[model samples]
Target: MNEDQENDMIQRWVRDTPEEDLKPEDYQHIKTLGSACLTEGNSAQLLTFIQDEKNQGIVKSMGFVLIEPLVNEVVKKEKSLEHCQAAITHLTRVSKLFINHIMRHFFVSSLSSGMTFLLQLDDRKAACVGLVLSALQKQLTRLPVPYTKQLEEADEYGLCRCCTALADFTKSFVQEIKSKNGNYVGTTEDEELRTELLKFCMRSLRELLLDAELSRDRKSSLWLFATEIMVTLPAIQQSLSELLFFNSLKKSIQMDDCQSKESRACLAYLLFVQLITIESFPAVFSPVFVLQCNMEYINQLLSRYAESHLLKGLALYAKSLESVEDNSLPVSLLELQSFYNVPQNLRHILTDCPMQHLRASGLQVFQLFINKLDSEAKHKFFRCMLKTRNHAGVEGYIIKNIKNQVEFSMKPGNASKWFLGVEFLSLLGLVLHLSQGAETDLLNSMDRIMESLNLLRYLLIRDKELRSRTGVWEELCRIKDDYLKMLRVCISLSRAYYSAELKALKDNQKIKAKDQQTDCVLCRYVSQVLHSALVTFDLMESLIVRIEELTEEKLKIPN
Candidate 1:
């Protein structure tokens, strides 16, 4: 259309009585006028049209349409640099007008749309878009905070969207912008964007980000964004400490009505796990205190069936326990409930997790946590596992570690003497008994039986020392005799049962081969499993014999 015809159409549309609700066609026509302004190099005219008294209602309803085309024009690659620069300047004016005029009264969703688009653009094109936003930074800085109360009032006019977009924008420069004597490098604009974006992240942590009602996907995404900013900008760590302070953390301690407390816990989890390096973790809050404060949160996450939550919880625990000293623990074991609860969740992960890698990771963390404790803690932990944890695989692990601690304590000057006393013998008694006698399900108790045999063998091999301990050798001998006799009976019965099954499967396989039928794949699998069980029993019997030999050898030696 010619200039006069376009101007006349614009005037007619802008001056027309505002619709109660704009039709789709009305939005299209408004966008067409915005495009016309860009084409005519008079982008100011669109803003003027919005500013007109008659079009105030239309502008409030559809001002976002006016800004959209200006953003498009700035990002248009075919345009000359001069043309793009002009478009950016006009976009700045339109943005300011929208934030001041439309956003105050109604939420403007497109306020961050240009930014989202810019993120996808080539560097040069994005730079042009950045210039547009840079001009609007003053207006954006004036927008209300993104917390719920203010959002309820006016939605921060899309400031949340802006913050998320700027977060992505800030990430690209993180590696390039190095700190020199505490001042940031890069352009004035990047430094400014980083400062403003950090403020938004911290505020969100205090408010919007802390809302417990936030979806898991949303919460995780926000966490990643916030972590990137904090990691890249080390200076913000101190500011983050203020919000995540131990004393200030009491608001969410009960975790009943407060979403912020839970949210704060999540932030702490991410910071310590992903953002803060292990060596640099602040000494102000003891690792135990951090663990205590976040114990419920950690347990809640670990209890979740999702692999993501499980992994996140594991990472948090690993960091929380990294710096903790055995001596730093309180005198009352009751105070260590959180530390106590971790092993059960770790057991669940080990036995129940469908993912193999995650199970391996859980085991590594579990063993590391166990190794960090002193001998007394290890003793109590082993007893607790034997009593409460019914899973044989888990019980076997506890027994194995108990055996390890015993060996460690026996070494000269080891300082871990708790495992060498009457308490150790008592702990040993709980796990060595075959509760159901020979009728026990050998397949089910495979791990427990094997580890128990190893523990007995180790004790027997250390007979030189035990014989001098008075009553210790006699008690161990009795425990060994009873345990081995019952074990021999159970192993014989199990080997007989599985051996028959294996022979039957082999016969079945021969019949299938003669008939030229599909091979009994299931029969082969059953045979393999049965054979493995029989082999395991063989290992157990050998262990029993080795223990007896050591006992006989020790008897010949004078005390």
Candidate 2:
């Protein structure tokens, strides 16, 4: 129709139709009028009607019928600037209205169906997302305080109502993008749009879904959205499934920054706590591969000092190691040295983590992984770890495990040659002998020093067979004597140095009180280290005298 007829119809509609009595057909006529104004390069008339205060009841009665055309016009590539602005204006006004039940349904339907389709079109996807994201942002002001019950109420802009709609909207496209079961044909442009859409969803996760201020209920809503976005996408599902199921070492993949460390931790938490409980969780492969896929990622999480990241990483590591069988790792796989990576991350938890519970849990998981290996693998790991794990506490932990394994090997009917051979002796030799900087090494590595002494004491008291082996017992004696002589020297040097330092710290008159306070703490730490060294030296001396008595007894027996 011409502009004259359109104006006449608008006048008639305004003049005659009762707001309460207008039929759907009348609303359809309003939509046509709006679309016509859009086509004619001017939407000022409809915008005026929507903007005017007196006509609001009639506009409300029309019930979003005009919005669809305005949305369509706004996304059109050939639309005039005036028309697009008017369309946006009309949308903005309707947005500020009190969203009733009909408007909520319209928004839900739009997100689930109409906008989903619009987001697929290359020509319109950007404008369509811009509009929807704009609407999503507009709802933020009206949202209740985070973690409040008021967020459960229906909102003014229907954001809470459309959460599931948005989630489902994302899920459908992800399935199509990753589906391999059918001869589903799609264009390059369509694929790009689908990929872009999912990227947009990931961006929304960081920007909108992960808002710390969202109520628990709304947070759950966003999580469901995020879950659908992750679970339905083939790449993510396949990546997680392979990690959780397969055994091969896959190449490390770098994810988008949108998959922040927080997002990754959340993903791990969901898998370990929620998804793994279901029988449908893929189990065709082994859990060992899960660690392989996630080893680096888990390390990244565990490497962080944040408790949330640490807890999530620990939980994931425990679950991954749960079903793995002892002695299941092949020699070839062990040779890859990938298993050595765990100790570096575990060091944080085992030695320096501020949280006591986390430290305890970390030690538990560390032993759990250790328990999964066989004697030969354990020996290899110990040898490799001792050489590579530079941290004194971590090295001490490895030494303690070595001692345990040696005791296990000597058990009746459980004999294992891996821990008794020259290789095993050499591993011990590395820790049992003093280096050139013996005093400094002993002072700094009190844990390693103590654990080494304990391991030597255990071997001397229990392993009677070593004396029968050619040169083994004599080499052990030589190393023990050398280690003891160095330990005695270290004890003396440490006591003298720390004592002088403490006396100097106390006697310095010119030191400021704050500076003295800090130095006093340092003095206390040094004193503690010195005390530990002295205790370790006493243990070494007792073990030394016991070894000498054992040697005398062997001499009296005669060969």
Candidate 3:
């Protein structure tokens, strides 16, 4: 048949073939004709026929039977690079025509099948892998935003499958490189092909790392992929390290100057930091550690950018040191400690940085160091912290910080303000707990109780104000109710204990042989505890009343 007649015949067959009734043999026949058209340099006719949008549902239903098996067939032939490349190119072109959930699955599966075959061909693996990856990258990039949004919002299982497939492809590609023993002694074309493949892998990783559409769980899979590559293939570690660090640094720099870019850059920085400090992986002496030895790198980061995310990244890097198993500190860590002066830096950050997040990071680093220390060291550290102005006054400082957060949240268009407020409240609770331990003398418990009541009162007022404006009373209600319940029980116990102590003091006063001064001190202590308990009861009662008013107002709102 002439080309025009053949084309007309295929078009008729495509139209006549009922999608529901089509069998494997029918798809095989179509694949055969498509392959012939591709070989005869009439790809335009073949593409136009197969890619007709009207037949998309039909084509999508036949995707696995039509495309995947053909890909497998081409892969199984152990063909020359040109043959394999042509097959992949044709498949890629056809895959682009139908971009949907079903097509993505079929396309990725086909590419994965091809990759399995290509990895076995020592001479052609580089070029073949590059082609397959390029195809996969194109398909992923072309994923419709609505589809991706669906994955992000509700289709966690589908999202996980997609992320796993991407990670598997990355793992396979890295395995191919590792199989070569980091030696690519091939022709210029082969070397260039390998370079392109590496770049493709890096780009895939970059996209995965920086993909804002992905949830943390999906992004974590990518981190696992990158860490596996870094652990198994030493050569790529340096390049991957440089890529992640530079990308994070770039984003951090942008974040410092642009408030609008903060969320994206901050997320990217956090993911990169996780990649940079793959402490969960078994320890290998990596050259990347050498970068840590230079205090100048950290100093430059601190001196150059005042962003909280950057500081948080640095804090995470420092925290990674605790993962080391040996008694002796890593030389890099020692250098970090000696030069960066982590405790001093944390003190400075806590005292100086106006941002709550930075202060939180500082606290995190301090806690990490404390946890790493021995009991004696921890004791000394706590003593030192108790004496430090910032540490001692952390409650007041954190309350002020929370007030600042509340003020910021009051601004219009702050969607995340409620979450930010919750975080600050949680932080306030933590500071209150820490302050309890800071009071070394039991005689000062009364003083600590009063301090806590004052903090709680301030928090209640602030919360009341916030609730009045935002109607965000659910969390505050829980906090207030829980505190009130606990305080009521404490007040009852204190009243009982005070009555018993008064009876004992009266008996001791009657017994002249007893130590009058000691009895007097005991009486005074009981009175103080009773006084603090009553004050706390009054404060909590006021808070409850305020909360009831807010609840009433909320209930009055029309549905």
lDDT of 3: 0.47
lDDT of each residue in 114-188, candidate 1, tens digit only? 655655664454355445545454345556544334343344466555545556555544433344325444455
Poorest 10 consecutive residues by lDDT, candidate 1: 207-216
lDDT of 2 by residue, 1-559 (tens): 4558655655666567665566767867767876777677666666766666665655655636666666666556444535555545455456433244333565565455556456456664544654554544344434432233355353444555566666665555555455633466766545554445544544444344433222223445545555564564443233545432342212222235325444444444466544522344555655776666556556656767766567767877887788788656554556543455656678767877788999999988888878888887788777777776467877888899988888887878666666665556778877775554445655557678778878887877765766656677677778777777776776667666766765675565236464654555666676676566656656656766766676566657644
Task: Give RMSD (Å) of candidate 3 vs. truth.
Answer: 20.4
What's the lDDT of the predicted structure labeled candidate 1?
0.63
lDDT of candidate 3 over 455-485, digit per residue (tens): 5555555554545444345665565556545
Number of the predicted model whose lDDT against the real structure is largest: 1
The best-first sequence of candidates by TM-score reads: 2, 1, 3
Q: Which candidate, 2 or 3, has the higher lDDT?
A: 2
Task: List TM-score per model, in order.
Answer: 0.60, 0.64, 0.40
Model 3: per-residue Cα lDDT at residue 23 = 67
- TM-score, candidate number 3: 0.40
What clash pairs does model 1 have?
Answer: none
